[model samples]
Target: MSAIVLLVLGLAAMAAGYLVYSKFIAEKIYRLDPDFKTPAHEYEDGIDFVPTNRFILWGHHFTSVAGAAPIVGPAIAVIWGWLPAFLWVVLGTIFFAGVHDSGAIWASVRNKAKSVGSLTGDVVGKRARSIFMIVIFLVLLMVNAVFAVVIAGLMMKFSSAVVPVWGAILVALVIGQLIYRRILSLPVVSVLGVIALYALIWVGPSVPIQMPTEVMPGLSGNAAWILLLFGYAAIASLLPVWMLLQPRDYINGLQLFIGLIVLYGAVVLLNPTLVAPAFNTDVPPGTPSLLPLLFVTIACGAISGFHGLVSSGTTSKQLNRETDARFVGYFGAVGEGMLALAAILAATAGFASVADWQAMYTAFGSGGVTAFVQGGAYIIHNGLGMPEATAATLLTVMAALFAGTTMDTGLRLQRYIFQEWGEIYNLPWMKKGAPATLLAVGSCLLLAFGAGGADGSGGMIIWPLFGTTNQLLAGLTLLVITVMLVRLRRPMWYTLAPLCFLLVMTIGALLLQLRTFYEQGNIFLLLMDIVVLIAAILVAMECAAALKRSRAEVAAEPE
Candidate 1:
């Protein structure tokens, strides 16, 4: 029940798992032979395929994995209880996430630094490669759509009379990049940019930015917001990475890191008691049991399918040494788990009444920007010397920065996947040497359509679907890693432990999703649930087939 105890236990579990268990997996199973040549060395291109310092690579990996999902998932999970949320994150990351990420990096490295799709095909079976690609494409589409809505909703909530703080920060970032990277030697430009960012925050309330008052008469604000956000995503996807996505992510990462520090520092300074119940006895009639829903709700922080794409798509190609993959991949998973822990701490600490948290949740429904700002403000007001309004505004700025970072990174990743998808599908219109600008634009449009809200509400209908798909992708990644471990002849106990845990958790979650869809009777959600269920079954069967084939091959070798 003690927050400190839980924190210590969680951290300890993560450390032991990564240091002891993961290292064992790396040495015995993955066996990154020192003599083996990595793809980065074999095909060293300056662009996308260059070797980089392990530390720098770690930075890139961490920045890519740590995003709005980490923040949002934990924030919501704590609604059930910090205990369930915290435990799932800790245990899940240690066993499920860390292993999956580490294994993925190793798999990619061992297979000539190919993407997971390519590796799956080469190692498991040719059919696996196609499955991997299709699964990833769908997952990317859902991920980008969900995030687009999240950012748009935040923007709509926060927009005011003065220049939009997020917009200003974005502009400043572009200008800073131009000055430092392109124009060269303008320290003042960067300094002025920072000052301008803060000033815009100060003046945010006075500035007026247009928000659609009514996208459709019957549509809820959230729905309308989703549509508009996805619409923007479509456009953003087609643009050059540098023009918006990369710069935004850099700013976002900086702000998120700083905000986390501030929040954690305040938690330590205040040492507030844990007031929420450790478990909720009265469950809603239709909600899932703790066994599965907990894992599903905390997907990103614990383990995410998205990480596989990141690992194989970019990080694997840039790894300088095979040994570095474990550090970058496993450590990155732990870091994300810790971020979820921070959110758990924030939601659980200092509040005497559940009503207080409920009030914030409701406010989030109505006044998205103000709700988070006020939540942060409330924490500061209770724990520090800052004025409530000032604290709220400061927190709001931080939240905006965080969202912007997520949007930028998410959009860029979406763009990459879109281009790859185009190539794979062999779209004639997307011929070689086509302008990067054209591709960016086209990708953005595709994303916008999916992210847009149904019924002209402008709120995204895709998010619920996205959540299911995202978790499904994670399950698929875990399945692949498990097969890889088996192929490498890892210790049965070591490979089976995490593999079995994830299989149960993910499959249970999928079933629960199916049940929910049937009860809700939402055709779209139901269809997604069915698709995920099928994917889950397919992943399970494929692993079984691979394992059987490997066993037969071993028997025939006469060794």
Candidate 2:
């Protein structure tokens, strides 16, 4: 029940996975060729397809995929029990997430850095690609919209975070030039970047920037923040990858790792015993059953479909060498696993007693990033002897930075989705970078304002579907990878096993949510769930057909 015990076990398992299992998967199963030309080098575009150093690429991939989900998911899932969430995070990261993420990057790299959605057309079928793209779009839409709101909410709620959150971007721009232009050595620049970022965090509380109560008539402060977030995302998306995205994500990645170290350090020093039970005998009345929900609830920390998106979408395009996928993609999964483990430790052990833990989880869907930041602040203060307000600002800035990086990547990925659609349907405008980015940002805003009304909070209305839809996409990503393995006549059991397990669990969870939505008369979510279910079914059929065709082609070849 000691926090250190949990932390040590999770860290050990993930380290072993990265060191041993990922190596095996990369060499034996993936058969990665060191000399194979990666898309980054082959395409050699300055904007989207620049070959990147493995360390910086890993930072971008890590922060983009880390987002708030890993923290939020495990933080919330602990309501079921810390033990279940912990085991899933440890096991799923090793067996499911690592393999899937690296496999996705490998798949995309082999196919010229196409996204998982586009790779589906080549590996699976065109029809499968169409369906897969829809699912991917919906997931991106939710991610871009909801994360904008999430970041804005955090900025509003923690005004002390405002300076650090905004200041990090300026620091990133300078670091980006320093690294890309080689004006400064990377080690020195990185150390300086981290130092500058932390300096901002130190100054944030003293000079908090609160949004005006009304930016204008009919626009509250929160709504103005949302608009500004989307505006920033739109600009960030259109900018070249190295300028803002890579450096920002990389610096954020550096600070977050330090943040995690602080958290894990706190637990080791204070040795807070878990107050939440291993299994909650006294369940919250309205909580869903644990079986399938746990899998979806703890989505990113364990295995998120979204990670596959990032792996294939952005990370694959920037891979310096084919072999770097293991370091960038799989180890990135380990980084997130460590974060989720910290969240579990924070939520379960941060509280003083069982009553305190129970009070936080009075209902399902409670205890997300707020729980993580508050609890993490407590541990930091008690263990590290940091002031509570300082500790809270630190954690808040970390969470906000994480969310902001996701929006940056999400908007860009959504832009890629539009460009992919253009390629599929032979539309010229959607293929253009500016137009695609506009469509990407435009669609999310439309959903926000069109659906949610004045406050631009409509994204929250469909937020519940994000977990289920994300899981479904992960399964389909694996399905596409499995089909590719079969086509190449590579051994696929390792990938296939997780794919099957996720599909079964996710489909079940989706159906359960569907029924619940219908019964509750929540027509919007019910319909969204049904649309996702249909898309999943159709894509599965296409992939199955593609799989059979691939098998026959392989079988007919003379040895």
lDDT of each: 0.62, 0.90
Give candidates' CA RMSD values in order. Answer: 4.8, 1.0
TM-score of each: 0.80, 0.99
Give per-residue CA lDDT, model 2, range 291-311, as digits (tens). 899999998989999998999
Where does model 1 exceed 4 Å of error?
15-22, 32-37, 53-55, 160-251, 358-374, 393-403, 406-412, 415-459, 492-496
State how far residue 219 of model 2 sits from its true place (Å).
0.5
* lDDT, candidate 1, at 216: 63
> At residue 410, what lDDT does model 1 achieve?
54
